[model samples]
Target: MGELFQEAILVSILAATVRIMTPLLFAAIGELVTQRAGIWNMGVEGTMLMGAFVAYIVVTAADSLVGAVLAALLAGALMGLLVAFMTVTLRVDHFVTGLGLNLLASGLTLFWFRSYIAGRPQPTFDGFENVALPGLSDIPYLGEILFTQRGLTYFAVLAVPLVWYFLYRTKYGLEVRCLGENPKALDVKGVNVAARQYCAVVFGSVMTGLGGGFLMLGFSDRFLAEVTAGRGWLAIVAIIAGNWMPKGVLLAVLVFAFLEALATHVQVIGVAVPHQVFLALPYLASILLMMGFKVRAGQPAALGVPYRRA
Candidate 1:
């Protein structure tokens, strides 16, 4: 009986882990893609907040999941353009620019939610629903954790390989890295470094936006102030912890998710620890992971520093 109970608890933890990790996976992928293009965008959290707001607003307006997703992407792209324009084009400090952007996102969302939709009715919208495969979901212990999840979860999984190909397999990928390392060298090689940087940053923004949208539509039903929470910042840490690789990012997200799940379990089982301390476990672990083995060495040379055009 004790063994059976342990198995059940394990399964439950796995389920919770998957749920928490999905958003982190999405945000980490966004940061990874942006970094591969040679910009360390720490504004992922802010972009995520905007995306969440976009999703909530759009879903409330159009009452469509697709619409909500598209809106979030558009918002992300716009924000990406702003970042690229300031950091890549204007040659501003990437760190300062990113921080400013995050603050902007938070302020804007909070302001809009307060000014426009105070005391509004329940947002009428449907979100990404769990998809259960036939044979896969039939598995005894693992099925519930792996197979029964929203469709967006599959997208997050698929993004890993697709991102790898974009960064490693394609010619454009080479230019992005080149631009990050030495834009002057790429410029001499006749590569449009600015354009490449712009594209990479935008792509990252779009992914972050989608992740934020997913939070609203697939993860939660309603919009709360700062609904994106701190997943964006967590993703940035995951990016460093993942060693700037797509697979690494995925693994980091999984670890974070697992920690969150464990923390949740501890709280539920009345572990006698302060709930806030348990909640802080995943973040603490991420810090340790980033500090221990996966030090922030793989970061782009041009990260957080604006590139100057020669």
Candidate 2:
């Protein structure tokens, strides 16, 4: 272990962990917002997949990164639109609706991918250029990885504060949280419970889409079916594990990211550990985090139930 720590490979592994954590953080905070509004959105995976595909498609076509990202956001919001429609307008169960959306996203993206790319060697765009923060870019060791990540990385970092303030410091945020606890009570108070919930779902979904797009635009630059893999689910778990707080969620994502980093690092360092065992590190860490911690924290009172007018 001491010899492994001395290797330069550890630095690369740690940097990769930070890169992985950024999108997870984005998705976690987004889920936190939606859940706080009393809605459990399982469609994050779908939203992200859609966003990633759209972003890659656009980038590959127009060769414009900004356009691809914006389109990805809109595509994500559109997915959220579906979730909002079913859960809020049609008054379906949030969990059922969310699950349905996930299936739809998976199937739909696969359909499109098969049609467009013939399904093998999936389409890819060039990865984003790393943008270094002035002065900070020159710092030794930690500088390049932290300061020179892609544009989306910086945006995801900024989203932490923006989301934190929106949830804690805004009137709409309070109403959203209130609706989660008691939509009936919020309705009685003229809060337009459905409207607020719809906004929350859509907003959360847009972030999900952006997070997905970040996967392609920033890192992978490729559109493989279900390329998001299980990161979206991890995001949901991150929310639960973080107890729905921004800082807590960030920390949780870091833990998940670190495990992934460690697994890859062990392999690279040729640790006698089996490669498959190393691969299990991230998932094992998540299972441990989920199983070990009995995160008893304040949750929105009426979360997951659809509100109907009496």
Candidate 3:
């Protein structure tokens, strides 16, 4: 128990917490935009999975990280396009459309993987390496935990403030928020409600895809079925638990990341607890957060409600 609190172990855990926070933060902040536009976008998990699978395929085949990331973004856009079509144009229930998309991505990726690797050893790729910020990374405990990480980790952290500015400071951002709170108001002003929603959904998905791509390139060496595990769902929970504010969402993601990081460290320190218990910590924390965190002041009024002009 004391070993767990050792300086070295503590630093390692905090650094790992930051690393683990990257993907969930990216997805949560991105989805913040989607939900703000009144699109429920239940397909985050599927879209992220698709992005990860695409990234794995492209990296293994081309050995180009840049190309793989781009492919992931494109895949996410396509998934987002489908989501937009169903929810915005066809007026399908957002929840149902998202659920269906998840199923589709899960099955499609599994089938494609099985076919691609028919009788061969599954290929793996070298993922991203840590890039320590020169002066910043030289600082004491904080530097190691915060400044030395994969490039995308920095971006994911910066994105929270950037997203917050976009949502609250930009005129277009106001229009987006309006779409979620009262689409009819925008329609009355001759704003193209559908177009805004489409853009918002696509933007969210593109970021979500990038998050998935990073998960593949930064962490895993080989692809597996459902490689994303439940991180995507955790992203959704972060948004809800954060009450839809970018800052709140960031904090929620950090909490989850910290729990996961703690779990990994527990195993390393030879905790007598069952391994499964450590693995379950983050999910259990999520449930508890949702149960106790009841403030909904930041939730958009019309979230999950589709808009149709009559």
Candidate 4:
């Protein structure tokens, strides 16, 4: 028990928590924006998987991280466009549209993978390197835990404030918020509700894709099918558990990440528990968090509803 509380082990857990939280934070912020705009996109998991697959492909072929990330962003945006078309332009049920997209992404990526890399050894690429902040990385425990991390980790952390400012302080954000509560009012006032919704969904999808790309580039040396490993679902859960607030979402992500990190290191700490119990820690923690923080308020009223302008 005392060994588990050692300073070095504690710092390692903190650092691992940050790394695990990065992808979730990116996806949660994007989902938060989409929900605020009154669109319930359940295909987040599939979209993330697509982005991971695309990043792997580009990186394997071109060996360019920039190209890989851009490709992922484009793929995610295209998926968002598809969702917007089905739910906004065609008035299809949002859930059906999202489910269909997930299925399509899953099938398409699998088919491409089997066709291209069939019987071939899995391709590997150099992932993003950690960048140490000048002067900050030198600080005792806090600095090493927070300052020395991958570039995407920093971006994910910075995005929290940027998203909050955009959602609260900007006119576009005001409209987005209104769209979720009463899009009819915006339509009556001559604001293009569908257009705004489209923009919001696409923006969210782009961010989700960036998250997937980071997972592939920063977390793993080689790509595997289903590389996202349910992080997308966890992202959605974080948004709900956080009551749709950015700071709350950040905290939720941290909680989940901490559990995941602890799970990873449980065996190393010489705990007497079974390894399987340690492995399930993250999911168990997620369920507990969701159960504890019931979403009784703050959800968009029109979420998951297809809007039909009269």
- Using lDDT as the measure, which candidate wins? 3
For residues 18-134, could you state the per-residue lDDT of candidate 4 as single tens digits?
988898898999989999999988889888988888999999989999999999899889988988888889988888887898889888988998787889887889988889899
Residues 30-105, model 2: lDDT tens digits: 8788899988898888898998888888898788989988987898789988998998889888889988999998
Whole-model lDDT, candidate 3?
Answer: 0.92
Question: Which RMSD does model 3 reach against the true structure?
Answer: 0.8
Error of 2 at 197 (Å): 0.8
How high is the CA lDDT of each candidate model?
0.82, 0.82, 0.92, 0.88
Maximum-TM-score candidate? 3
Off by over 4 Å in 4: 268-270
Can you tell me which runs of candidate 1 are displaced by over 4 Å?
A: 1-5, 121-126
Model 3 ranges off by over 4 Å: none
RMSD of 4: 1.4
